[model samples]
Target: MLSTNPFALSDTRAPLYFSDKVALVTGGASGIGMATAELLAREGARVVIADRCRDDGEELAARLRHEYGQALFVETDVGCASSVQALVGRTLLEYGRIDCAINNAGLSETPVDLIDASGEQWERLMAVNLRGVWLSMQHQIRAMLDAGRGAIVNVSSRTGLVGKPRLAIYTASKHGVLGLTRSAAIDYAPHGIRINAVCPGLIHTPFVEQKFGDGLPELARTMNPLGRIGRPEEVAECIAWLCSDAASFVVGVSLPVDGGAVA
Candidate 1:
C-alpha cells in the first residue's frame, strides 16, 4: 500500500533555492495549488495566492505568513481577464517582479458524453481551463520580459494526454494548455524565460474529494500502476522544481506526475 501521509511536510527543509524570488500561484486556495504555494514559501519564495475563494485564500495566506515569512492572497477569477490582470498588477506592485508562476487555476466537467455535452459546459471549461492559462501567461510573460528571466509551470493533467469517455471538454481544455505552454516556451526561451507543464493523475485534493468522494481511492487504485491516489504535495514538488534554477535547461515539457499511469 502507498504511504497514507503523502502530504507530510518532511521535505520542506530542502535548500532555500528560491530565496529572494517571488512566486505566484493561481487557484491557490486549496489542493495542488495550495500545496505548491506552501512548498514554494518554505523554499524561501515570497508567495502570492490568487483564487476566487476569498475565505479559503485569505486563510491560507495567513497560515503561510505565520509559517513562512511572506505571503499574500489576491481574490481573483482566472476566467476573467480583468481579474487576472489585476492579480498580476498587484503582485508586481508588492514584489516588484514575478520570478516564478504556477498557472494552476482550472475547472473540470461532470461526466457526460460528448454527444450530450452542452455548449455552456464547453465554454465554461475553456474559460477557466484554457483561457485562464492563456491570460495568465500573457501578463506573466510581460513581467518576465521586463525582468529578463523567469519560469512558469502550467498545471495540465493526464487527461490532456489521453481522452476519457465522458470528459471531452476537460480533455480539450488541457490539451489547449499544453499547446499554450509549448508555444509560449518557444517564444520566450530566447528571452531567458522558461515555460512548462505538469500533467497530474488522480491527486487527492479537496476538489477531487468533492467530485469523487469515497469512490476516489478505489478508482485511483485501479487507474494508476502505483495503486493509490497521488497527493497534492507530490505534484507541488514538480511545480517547484520546474520554477527553480535547477530546471533552467528544462522548458516546454509536459511532465506526467501520474505514478506510471501514463507509462
Candidate 2:
C-alpha cells in the first residue's frame, strides 16, 4: 500500500531532502523525466519542467503545483543553445537558484545497420541525444557555479556502455553523453558541483513500447538478466539519490540502472 501522505515516503534518511531547493528537469513531461520531476516535487523542491511538449509540460507543472506548492513549465528545445539558456534563465528567475538539474531530453530511432545509416539520422540523434545534453549542461553548470553547489544527473542509456546491433547512431550519441558527464564532473567537482550519468536498461516507457511493439514482452524477458522491463520510477530513484546530499561524496560516476544487464 502506498502512503496517502506524499511527504511520508520522500525518504527515510531525510523526509524532505530537497526541501527549499530548485530542480530543473528537461523532457520532464513523460517517462523517466516525469518521474524525476514528481519525485523532486514530493521531496519539497520547487520544480521547473522544460520540454518542447507545451501541453503536457504545463499540465504536469500544474499538477505538481496543486500537490507540492511550487512548479512551473517552460517549453524548451535542448538542441538549441538559446532555448536552453532561456530555460535556465527562467528557472533562476522563478526559483532563484538551481540546486539540481537532470538532462533527460533525448531522441532515438528504429535501429538501422551501421553500413546503411544516413548522415541525416546521425545529425538528428546527435542533436538531441548528444548536443542537447551538452548544451543543457553548459547552461546548467553556469547556474550551479553561481549557486556554489549542485548536482546534475544526465540520462545516458545501456547503449552508452555497449554496442547495440543496429543502434549504432544511438549508441554513439549516448556514449557521447557519458563522456560529457565525466569530463564536466571533473571540471566542476572542485567548485562543489557533482555531475554524473545514469545508464538505464530496457525501461518500459512509451518509447520502449513504441520501439518494441508486439515484441516488447519477449524483449523485456531477454534484454536484461532480471528478465523484466525496468520502470521509469526505478531510474528516478537512482537519479534522486544522486541529486541528494546522501551522494555528496559521489562525482563523475556512470551508475548503471540496468537490472544487472551490464554485469
Candidate 3:
C-alpha cells in the first residue's frame, strides 16, 4: 500500500503522502475544489488546477508555486470534450502521468420545480455536472490504466441520495455522478484504480453565499442534524483521505460529508 504517517497534516514533517504524485482537480479555482487542491499541494503533490475562472486559477497556482510546489492552472470548460482533452494532454505534457483526479466542476441552478424547469436549465446543468464527469473519467481512467494505478473522487450532493423541492435537475445531475462513480469503481478497481463519490450537504461556499445569502443563518439552523453548514475544507479532508492510501480498501462509497442529514 502507498502509505503515509497518519499525523495531522499541519505538522511540517508529516510524511508527504502525495510527494511526487501528480494530481488534477477540476473546478479548482474555488470552493471545495480549491481546498482540495491546496491540501494536495501542501502534502507534496504536483497539482493541476483546471477551471474556467482564469484569474483565481492563475493566482492559486502562483501561490502554490511560491510555496515550493509544482502547480499549473488551466482554464477549462469541463463540458467540452476538446477542452477536457486538452486539459489531460497538457497535464501529461508537463508531468508525464496522472495519479489522482477530482472531477469537481459543477454549477447549481436557482430552485425551480421540475414541472416548471425549462429544458435549457436542465441541459446546462447536466452538461457540466453529469457529462463533464463522464468526459473527465473517460480520459482520466485511460491515463491511469496506462500508469497501472490511480484514484478518482467525484463530488455529488446530499440530494443525490434523497430529494429536495425545486431542485430536481441538480438532484438528477448529482445522482448521475454517484452512478458513474460506483460503476467505474467496480470496473477499474481490479485495474488498480479506486473511484468514489462525496455527497456534501449545504456547505459554506461562494456558491452557497450566492444561493442563500442573508438567509444563511436561518438556513443553516434547519438544514441538517448538525445544525450548521459545513466548511469546504471539511469535505476536502474527506476527499484527500479517500484519495490516499489510508483509504486503500475503500471503493465505490458515496460518503456523506453532510452533517448527518442523510442519516
lDDT of all predictions: 0.92, 0.91, 0.93
* Alpha-carbon runs more than 4 Å astray in model 3: 1-7, 10-15
lDDT pick, better of 2 and 3: 3
Q: Name the best candidate (by TM-score).
A: 3
lDDT order of candidates, best first? 3, 1, 2
Instruction: Put down candidate 1 lDDT per residue, 70-100, tens digits, no spaces.
Output: 9999999998999999999999999999999
**Top candidate when judged by lDDT against the true structure:** 3
Stretches of candidate 1 off by over 4 Å are 1-15
* Tens-digit lDDT track of model 2 for 123-217: 99999999999999999999888879899999999889998899989999999999999999999999999999999998888878887799998
Per-candidate TM equals 0.94, 0.94, 0.96
Error of 3 at 10 (Å): 4.9
Where model 2 places Cα greater than 4 Å from the true spot, the runs are 1-15
Clashes of 3: 0
List, residue by residue over 1-263, the lDDT tens digit for candidate 3.
33254425653375377889999999999999999999899888999999999999999999999984699999999999999999999999999999999999999879987889998998999999999999999999999999999999999999889988898999999999999999999999999999999999988998889877899999899988899999998998899899998899999999999899899
Q: Worst 10-residue stretch by lDDT in candidate 1?
A: 1-10
Which pairs in model 3 have colliding backbones? none
